[model samples]
Target: MQITLIAIGKTDRAELEELISIYAKRLQHYIKFEFRIIPDIKNSKNLSEAQQKEKEGELILAQLQPTDTLILLDEKGKQYTSMDFADFLQKKMNSGIKNLVLVIGGPYGFSEAVYAECSGKISLSKMTFSHQMVRLFLVEQIYRGFTILRNEPYHHQ
Candidate 1:
């Protein structure tokens, strides 16, 4: 199955963008991967946290297909080890999912509506990282997961 990473806004930092692109390119060898960046909301400074999330949620929802399995990268979501994440991915593919969409929400997090629409959630770490950093981390983990599945030397026990 194909995998799509839906994140809000572009990566402003060149280093982070380059690193994200490196991992993303590496991932293409194993699976169909796409990183969908939703532009930041206009005049976001004037909006409340809830309102921003609501608008971002609308944009995020629009990128999804009816057959896609939506998974949010959330702070409160389940945290899996590299190997376990590979298994999670394997299970999804085995189940015959068409498109697996993983979302990284905006600064204030997701709205109640977005949460309700997701099939599952995954947390990369307990400590918080910048949204830009989260994009890189997620892509690297996906690459690592695939490497582990292939019994590559990239991941060590």
Candidate 2:
């Protein structure tokens, strides 16, 4: 199955971008993975939090196809261990899913519409993290999960 990560805003930090790229490249060896950035909304300063999320949600939803399984990266979502996450991925692939779309929402988080459209949610950790940092962390974890599944030496228990 193809795995796509859709996140709002660009990664402005060069170091973080480089790290995300490294993991993304490594992930290509195991599964079809793509990182698509949804540009930040213009004149966001004037919009209310709800309004911003609504606008961003529109763009996020637009990127999806009918058959894609949408999953949101939400703080209040289910948390999984590294091995468990690998198993989750394995199950999705086994089910013959065409694409698994994981989304990271904007600053104020997702809109009600986006929440309703998602099939599930996942949390990397209980601790808060910058949206840009989450991109790197998620990619690295995905790469690690694949390596663990293949019994590679990249991931240590």
In terms of lDDT, which candidate is strongest?
1
- TM match of model 1 to true structure: 0.98
Write model 2 residue lDDT over 99-140, tens digit each, in one string.
999999999999999999999999999999999999999999
Range of the 10 consecutive residues with the lowest summed lDDT in candidate 2: 140-149
lDDT of 1 by residue, 86-108 (tens): 99999998999999999999999
Q: What is the C-alpha RMSD of each candidate to the true structure, in Å?
A: 0.6, 0.6
TM-score of 2: 0.98
Worst 10 residues of 1 by lDDT: 57-66
In candidate 1, list every pair of residues with a backbone clash: none
Query: Runs in model 1 with CA error above 4 Å?
Result: none
